[model samples]
Target: MRNKSRKIYSMLFLLLFLWGVLWEAESVYAANWGSVELTAEEAVLMDADTGAVLFEKNAEEKGYPASITKVLTALVVLEHTSPDEQVSFSHDAVYNVDRGSSNAQIEAGDVLTVNDCLHALLLKSANEAANALAEHVAGSREAFAEMMNEKAKELGCTGSHFQNPSGLFSEEQYTTAKDMGLIAIAAFHNEEFMKIEKDLRYTLSGLQRLPEGNILYMEHKMMLPESRFYDSRVVAGKTGYTRDSGNTLLTLAKEGDRRLVTVVLKDKSPYHYSDTSAMLNLGFQETEKQSLEDAEGFLEKIRAELVEKGTLTEETKLHFSSKVMLTLPKGETQEGISYLLLEEEAEKKEISAAEAKASDSGMPDAKDSALPHIVFLLDGRKVGEANLYREQNIRVMLSEASPKTKAAFFAVTISGFTIMIAIAVFLFGGGALYGAKNFADERKRRKKWKDRRKKRLEEMKISEEEFRILLEKRKKEKKN
Candidate 1:
């Protein structure tokens, strides 16, 4: 009877231990999203500020971008051309798209400004508007495609190529989900593009070419407030689909000041939205926004380096530029973050259209290029960066001339006086010019007198007190 009771008690203890282990495992699994299923063939979620990869699935695999290509189209157009510039549609642009496809209902003779065309290009997914803007800005579709590829390289996209302004399916055109995320990040930072991307409706300047009010409407229905997939946090987005590519979506959302860009490629009808939503929710829950402002720790680090190097005074207050922000996993310390000073002026995570254009053309402004930049790297990758500036009380002493400079000035003055006196005596004497011999002797005597005066002035250097006393005496004499 005693052995039987002991066996039963041991069995119960073993069961309880196993259950505890299983529960702990489940919690960790949930944190890692091991059970979160995704239907997209390729997708990526990235933090806009830190460029941290929160989650991704086959994100680097190349796939068709479809109409998402227009984001790049609008980006390039906004950079190279002004909003008021006019674009005229040619017969080729009007009829070149795949038959039974999307368009802004433009005819061969239709004309619109660059701004209006952008509204049509992005909001209406107007293939015709894309072609017309491309030709107007770069003079041909091939040239515009090259510009797109060049811009893609500048954004650090490795798996992408462009064949046309509009993402009409082509055998040569391809992009990865991660690459689209990069492109979306660039577009999200653009002020003009963001303004156009969020508008549910717009009245184009080409009112005659548009509907009753010359208005263009968005076709991304999911962005509508009443839609089932509508997310209030979504600031801007674009959607695309083709028979071969299936569905593609790109969106930028923010819970607060922390922004995230999510992209999904080769997905079904509702999965694109679901995948994007899942990634966004998980990202917000897992990551924390860390601002690198004038924290005492950071300031101290900067000051220590400056102090140890014996270059800057301890009083030189240090501050980071307000433009940079960091993203990290929740409850994590900044122990892993490291920094290095950059020799060249680094580009900002966000830049204006003019600055983007200027940078692309290899001509950043002089003032921007001169600031000292500190790039923060995490896990050997640049996670955040900003300019480091020193604020100090500049004690500007009145510039005092050195003894050598004073001596030089005094000698020049004495020489000039001697020459002027000789010239005045000769000119005002009312007599003929003296013989060359006599004039030469006079010059020698004047030169000797000037030299003696210079030597005496050099030997009789006065202290600051003596100089002040003499100056006061001169003022009194002048007053009397």
Candidate 2:
């Protein structure tokens, strides 16, 4: 009876322990799951300052980007034409848009300033305004579209293409949340763009088209001060919709110093705002920003190396052309961040013998002094990059000259039998060290040359075998 009781107790203890372990495992699984549930089919939460993705779901999936096209349209227009530039509406610009679609009702031959057009474009969601602005900037809608596509490519948008300036329904026109995010980030950098986006209302008083002042109210419901969904953190945003494309929104908001850009596409009514709010909250709760310049010790170490190598001098003014921002989870240390300094390829130019001599004598041409890019990675994924520049010219300093040159100078100064014997021993004994150093340097030089050759071949769209044959032929010609 006693043995049976003890066995029963042991069984109970083991079962309880097993149940506790299972419960803990379930808790951990729940913790790993994302904190927010969104209704959008494609969405992304990005750090506005750093361009770092905080959360994403099907961000690369292409979908119709209705009025959001105007955001890019406005950006491109602002890049080419000033805000005060006069825009004349043509018959095509006014009548090309669908009659039932939102329009500013400007007649052909009527004119308005670019600033007024942008107000109508953004606030009233006017299709005619977009068309008029496009024509004014590029002389024709087709050429303006080419500029848009080029701008998209420059912004690293691979999954997006623009067939028209306005976000009208087109089979070929589509964009992804990821691509729009990049475009929005670039646009936000423009002060005039943000200023236009942040307006609650815009009234165009002196228009050449309209006799009475046109009062335009904000079209974005969530951005309205009286709306229940209105968030004070929201700085600027754009909204879009079409029959084929469901409601889409690209919004920028800031909480404290942490700014977030949210893109939600193909979402049901009101859900885009709800989904964006949830994601923005999660981003603020989970992430913190760290400036790359704060890595003082790390930067000092690099600066010391640059100074020792004669790449820079103490008197040389180092002005960082770019500033890096790292966004990471709150409470997580910066141990995961890594950096790589990559020099940009300088343009190769042919110079006369006199010019070459001048270049070799501590006076490098502009083509010879390309700046370097500092790339930052978090958890092995690229987070951000910045350029490093120096105001002073690059040259070797006397104090930091290579040891071999100093030794050669010393050998030349001492000329005698004993000195000759010393030199012979030095040459033979130092051969091993010298050979190893030269081998390492040669490998670096070869790698750089190979990289340049590979880049050239890629640009020319040539095969490796063809490039090799061409290189050998050039070498033979040079030898001759």
Which segments of model 1 are wrong by more than 4 Å? 1-36, 203-215, 292-324, 338-383, 386-480
Give the 10-residue window scoring lowest on summed lDDT in candidate 1.
394-403
Positional deviation of 14 in candidate 2, in angstroms? 14
lDDT, candidates in the order shown: 0.78, 0.78
Pairs clashing within candidate 1: none
Question: Which candidate should be chosen as best, given TM-score against the real structure?
Answer: 2
lDDT tens per residue, model 2, 17-73:
999999998755321213578899999888878777778889999889999888899
- What tens-digit string does per-residue lDDT give for candidate 1 at 174-276? 9999899989989878999998877889876544455454567776665788788888888888889898888998888988778999999999998889988
Worst 10 residues of 2 by lDDT: 345-354
Clashes of each: 0, 0
Model 1 TM-score, 2 decimals? 0.63
